[model samples]
Structure formats: structure tokens, C-alpha cells
Target: MTTTTSSLLNIRPNFFYDKVINWFPGHMAKGLRIISEKMSSIDVIVEARDARIPISSINKKFEEVANVKERIIVYNKCDLAEESSQDIITKAFEKYRNQKVLFTNANMDRNIKTIINIAANKARENPQKYPFVTVMVVGMPNVGKSSIINSMRRLGVHRGKAARTGANPGITRAVSNTTIKVLENPTVYLIDTPGVMIPHIPDPVCSLKVALTGGIMDHLSDEEVIADYLLWRLNNFSNFGYVEKFKLPGPTDDVNVLLPAVSKRIGALHKQGCLRLSGT
Candidate 1:
């Protein structure tokens, strides 16, 4: 909670804020190593990503692992992101002819079924010439991998009855193996890996918003300007209407007019006489 001001930028800085910016811990390095070691045994890789930020959620390093096996991209939380954004994302991935892309709300039963069907198709089309097919579920924390597995089990697609599911994020922390019989064609095996936040080229502004809105930022940043930038983006982006409903102040064409407008809306008043528009 200690706040420090940066003389260079005239911005307040805090150690807690630094922690938020650096939330992706070093443990991911070990996770990547483990995934690399297990790639040989995996037949098809199922990657789950937030539909809101599909491109950002994906780890570029996945290309390295995917080169060894078939990759199926699952766009989870499709219900959250804007429809137009989702369409753009689907088209963007269409160039990867080798990969199969699927959009679904992993929390729902039908979408989970669709995912299973697509995965089965990907496994059957595998050119590796392997006798048995294996699919590994991967994604960032809270992307709904476990929930999807549980839904598959409910539909009787997954054979083992002991698999557990939960509502919270980071529920599945270890690799677990399970087997299922796919309607008399062949026996399918699945490997579930621990969800790790994929590291990417950081955009401090966008990352801050994603982390804060999704509860991913455990430590709050001390830089209010960063938050201001986020508010500005949210206000400008018509898709993020919820932000305006929160009555947050946002920048406009003219700082003078915009400041007073936002200050009144956010209830920031000056102690002496006028409204304190500086912070807004």
C-alpha cells in the first residue's frame, strides 16, 4: 500500500502496483519446460483462451509446442467479448489452416459438446499415424478447462467418474490423465495441464484493464494515470458500456471541458471553492 511519486513522469508509484504489473510469476518457466517434455506423447493440443482477448491470451511459445502436434484453439468465454471482435478473431486465425478454431461458452453444456466433437475430428484427422489419440487441454487460469471437462463427463463422453470441477480460477493446478471411449471408433485419452498465464509483449494499459476487470491483478497499481488511461479507452470503446455505467471520469477532446464534466459525474470537489477536476 506504500505509494511513491515518480519525479520524471509526475506519476505516483507504489510497490503494490509493481507487483500487479509483474503478476506473471517465474513459475511459468517451469510449466513451459514440463509442457515441452510432454509434447511427444500428446496427439492433439486443445488451447483455451479468453474470447475477449484471444490474441493476447495466446502464448506465442505455443507455436513451438504445436509444431510437434495438432493444435485446436478453443475460444472460451465467447459470451463476454463483443460479437464484432469475435468475428475478427475467427477470421484472423483462419490463416492457420493446420489448426481448428472453435468458439464456445465453456460454462454451457452444448458448447462443451461442440468442443468435444471438434476435438474428436481434429484427432481423427491427425496425420501422425498414431494408433491412439490423445488431446491435452491448455489455457490461462480461469479459462474453463476443468468446467468443460466436467460437462463432457456429464454428457457421458468422458469415462472416468472421479474428475472434479470448481467455480473459482486456478482450480486445476496439476497434470491429470483420463481416458474416454468415443462411440466405438477408438479410445481417446486426455491430458489436463495446469493453467498458466501466457506471457506476451506487455501493453501496460491494456494489460492493466484486463487484469483489473477479470480479478487477475492481485496487487493494485499506484499509478492513477494508468487507471485514467484505462477509463479513457473504455469510454471510447463503445463495446465497453459497463465502464460508463460505473460513472468514471474520462478524457475528451478538450481537457478543460472534459475535466469539469467528469469531475461532476465522479463527484470530485475542490476543498476551497471549485470542483477538483485535476484528478478527473
Candidate 2:
């Protein structure tokens, strides 16, 4: 639970870390523009975020574009986060009484129905005016947006995955041409949009959290920096799960000391027998 950085000693500054301040690419801009254009048709905006890094995963730009629509903040991948922390995360958003926050595990179909019901209920507030509910699903990359859409389709229509799901980020590149129908009674359609990031992530730590959680592309950030940050995070909470997982001699704060040991323990070596610290 500690946030001290004294453990990270003598680490050289990285170029990628410095440049990641303005990591926004052109595609993100285009995606934002597309979302803005479709705001007129969207009845509800489902903002998906990683349950582990809820605060950092949120795209601040969505607030400006989706402020008018009914926003449902879904903290996806709840199964991966600590169950005890859910209430704490929920309470953090209590101020947003206008917005509804739901923790969901899309892969397991948990809370899928509730999310649909909430969106439907919100849209039905003006049933005659808004007959068809058009829900726009937005979130950072690799946060299970497509998985949630697919789950909704499975429950609403008993159909298989309509939106493609992947383990990495940026799978949904842009808004799809075809609409995915999630419910039949009230006729709910979901518009799957690409995972868009803010134009600039001013805080480096926030950027690292996003990178470590796979919100941003892996190649965009150096592997070692991300791994190191992960190590620091694990050590901060005194979570030595990695020590057992990697079969290390003991828990160490220094990634330099840890990575080599991990590389050796796991036999992660090059063809020439050199230890692959980066690979580890």
C-alpha cells in the first residue's frame, strides 16, 4: 500500500518514458472524432474501464463528448481485481450520482443483464421519443469492451460474439459499419467504438499504470520499464506472489537484481546462452 520510490535506486532514465507524455497517436484522434459525430444517435454511453486501474483507464475526453448522454461506467475484469476492493472503488464514484457504475466480469457474463437493463431503463425514460436504444461502448484499449458487447449479444439474442475479442489492446480499431443488436423486446443496438486514449497523459505514473495493465500498446512502452514498474507495485503492496511464481530466491525491490534471477530460474536465455533480462 506504500507509494515510496526509494526502493528504485540507480535506475537510468528511459527515452520511451520521457516521450510517453504525448503518446497520443493520430488514430486516437480519429477515433475521438468518430465518437463525437455519433454522439447524436447514442442513447447511452457505456464507459468501460479496467477494474484494477479504474482511475487511470478512464478517457477524460469522453466526459466532454458523452456528457449529454446517460453514462454507465462499467469496471470490467472484476474477476482479476481483489473482491474486497470493489466497494472502495464503487464508493469513489458516489459523487457521480448522475452516472451509474457497475463492476462486471464480461467473460463470465456477470452483470451483463443488469448493464443491459440499466441502459434499457435509461433509454426507456423517453420510450416514445427514443424507441430503439443505441448504446455506445467506449473505454481504453484491451479493457474487455468487445467481450462485454459479445456477452450482451449472447444473453440478449442467444447469439455468439458479434464484436471481436482479443487479449491485447486496440482490437476494435474504429466504429463498426454494422450495428450489433443486444436485445429484441425493446430493440437495443450497441455501437462498438475503438479504444481511445487521451491526447496526452501528463502523469508518467498514470501512463505506466495504463501500460502495465495493457491499456496502451506493449511496444509503445519499453518492456523493462513496464516490468520494473510492475515489480515496484508488487513490492509496494508487499505482494510477493511473484517471488513464488517466478521461483526467486527471495523478494527484491530492484528489477535489475530480480529480472536476471527470474531469467535464470525460468531458463529464459538466448541461443548463445546469454541471459535474456528483457525477455524475462
Candidate 3:
């Protein structure tokens, strides 16, 4: 294990290192159009964000489409984030009049009932407006939009998955004709759209944070840079669980030292002589 420590490592102010990330694709454009067209019928907008990177995960483009709708901010993957940070995140959205913020672990069904109830309650306000409640789940790539719908379906209707789910980004390309039914009483349905990312990231810092959360495509950004940013964040926060997980002698801020030890421990090897640690 590499145990040599150099002078105090200054946290990198930026992770992009002057690299530009182009992540928006044709599918996202079409998805945005579909969402815009369907917003008239959408009674409630369940904006799902990655709880770990709550602020950075916000798709700025969504503000135009979702500003007028009844929005509930569901910060999914709460299990992956520090519980102490939830209150601080929640306090940021206190200015919104009709918006509700919730932290949920969709995989474990935690707070799924509350989400459904909130949406259902909001939709029920106007019984004459529509026959059924149409709720749209929206967010950046791989922030668990489909997973939240699937969880709500399993709990609300006791049914199988209505939306396809995966760990990678951009699984659902469009809002299909078949909307998933999450609640039967008063007739509630969910529209699962493709994970939408902002067309232009404001800066390199925002790009790296979004990329680290898997919001942007992995190939578009250097994995080593992303990994180094993660290490810097963890070390800066004094969180050193990676030391035990990677079998390192102690915490190290250098990605060069940590990556090699992790690669050897995880047996990551490329076909050629170079070591591959992309998925680590």
C-alpha cells in the first residue's frame, strides 16, 4: 500500500481541469419537448434529485417547464447521503409556496407512502379539473426517477414495475403511451420521462459534481478526474471509510496512490498492459 504523504494537499478548486463536457444528446431534446407538451396534463411534478448531490443535480432547463406546475422535490437515494445534511438541504427550499421537499430511499421503500400521499393530496384539490391525477417524475440522468416510480407502484397499487430501471443513465428515452398507475383511488398515474440534463453546464465545478453523481455520461469526462474529485471531497470532509474499504494503510489525497491500490485490490486489469479501474 502506498503510505507516503506529501505536503498538505490543497483541495482542487475545479475538477474539469479545463476539459469541456458535452452531455446533451438528441434524446434529451426530444424528451424535453415531450415533457413540455405533456405539462398541461401533468397535475403534479415529482422532481427527483440525487440526495448525495442535491443542489448540483438540479436540471436548470426543468425550471421553465416545471415552474408553473405543482412540484414536489423528492431527493431520492437518501440512504447514500449523510442524514445530518437533509435539514440543511430542506432549508434551502423554504421560499417556495406550493413546493414540498422529501428525502427518500426508493430501493428500500422508505418514505414512498408519504410521497404518494402528498402527490395524491395535491392532485385531489381539483376534482373537476381532470378525471385522473397525472404525475410526472423528472430529474437529471440516473437520479432514480424510474426507481421512485417503481417503488410508488409497488407500494401504492401492489403491482409490478411499470417503468424500466437501471443503474446507468438515460434508461427511459421518452414518455410512452403506457403510464404507470401508482394509486387506484381517485386514479393516479405516473409519467416516466428520460433523465434530462441541462444543455449547458454553468462551469467546470458544476460539471464535475454532476458527472460524479452519474448525471452526465462517464465517457464524456475523465474517470480519473472524477475519482480524484471524490477523494478530495471525502478527505476534505474527514470521511476516511475508503481507507478500510480499499485496504489502504491510511487515507491519502493523491488519486495516483489510491487508484493503484484500489485497482490491485479489486483485480481491475485491462486487456493491454495498462490497469483499468473505470468501474471502481
- In terms of lDDT, which candidate is strongest? 3
Better of 2 and 3 by TM-score: 3
lDDT of 1: 0.59
In order, candidate lDDTs are 0.59, 0.81, 0.83
- The 10-residue segment of model 3 with minimum total lDDT is 1-10
What digit string (tens of lDDT, one per residue) describes model 3 on residues 167-248?
6788888777678889988788888899988888767877888888888878788888888989988876767778888887
What TM-score, computed on C-alpha atoms, does each candidate reach? 0.66, 0.87, 0.89
The alpha-carbon lDDT assigned to residue 7 of candidate 3 equals: 28
Ranking by TM-score: 3, 2, 1
Candidate 2 minimal-lDDT segment of 10 residues: 1-10
Off by over 4 Å in 3: 1-16, 95-98, 122-126, 270-274, 277-280
Show where candidate 1 strays beyond 4 Å. 1-20, 96-98, 122-131, 156-169, 177-185, 199-201, 213-217, 220-230, 239-280
Worst 10 residues of 1 by lDDT: 1-10
- Cα-lDDT of candidate 3: 0.83
Query: In every candidate, how many clashes are there?
Result: 2, 0, 0
C-alpha lDDT of residue 249 in model 2: 57
For model 1, residues 76-115, the per-residue Cα lDDT tens digits are 7788778788677667767656557787775566466665
Model 2 C-alpha lDDT versus the unseen true structure: 0.81
Error of 2 at 193 (Å): 0.4
